[model samples]
Target: MLKGILEGCVLKVIFDNETYGYEISQKLQEHGFQGISEGTIYPLLLRMEKNGLIEATYKASVLGPRRKYFTITGKGKGELEDFLTVYKEMERAVHHLFAQRKPEADSEENTGFGEPEWEG
Candidate 1:
């Protein structure tokens, strides 16, 4: 199943400027996402627009139906900022949790005779 949370994250990421869902999905795939189906993204886009988090404008598509482009609304911008803050803090905390730290040194080893081993 697709992660709805990541879908919203991707939407906000693209909604930072005008963009379409297909392009957004392709970018998401390129940006290390997997199992992100159009089924998952299209509905979320609709929901966000319904909630006034975004606005959609249609553009002509030569090969198919007109394409709809979405942009972040002021409300979406506020939400994106809040989401970005929380996401960054969580990312930093996770990084710290997963980060490796140097061990305390013994007096004999502390004279820059050798380097500390690194991991993670």
Candidate 2:
């Protein structure tokens, strides 16, 4: 679930502007996606590049080596649209499901899955 969502998010970021992996990670963090390291971002970018959802080009930076920037392709925009549609449906369904729960259910200290909450 997260992989797919992350793909959409990466696509959206690239669609908004051509950017590199590190900048994408920073934008995600600024958007409330904390703790997502560049390690996680590079793999996703590689996969997106392989799938032709995005294309990368090396550009000379003011400091250090060249940076590989990403831009979304037409296919990627379509995928982002589809992802948004499906995400909205799922969000509504989850909200409705929780809203229908019995009021007594809220008093329990369970994990909300018919089991005790783990103390991890």
Best by lDDT: 2
Question: Local distance difference test, per candidate?
Answer: 0.74, 0.88
Tell me the tens digit of each residue's lDDT in model 1 across 1-120: 134457457656666568888888877787777766667688888888998888899999989999999988888887778777877887799787645344543333435233536733
RMSD for all candidates, in order, please: 6.8, 3.5
**Which residue runs does candidate 2 get wrong by more than 4 Å?**
106-120
TM-score of each: 0.69, 0.85
Model 1, CA-based lDDT: 0.74
Instruction: Estimate candidate 2's alpha-carbon lDDT, on a 0 to 1 scale.
Output: 0.88
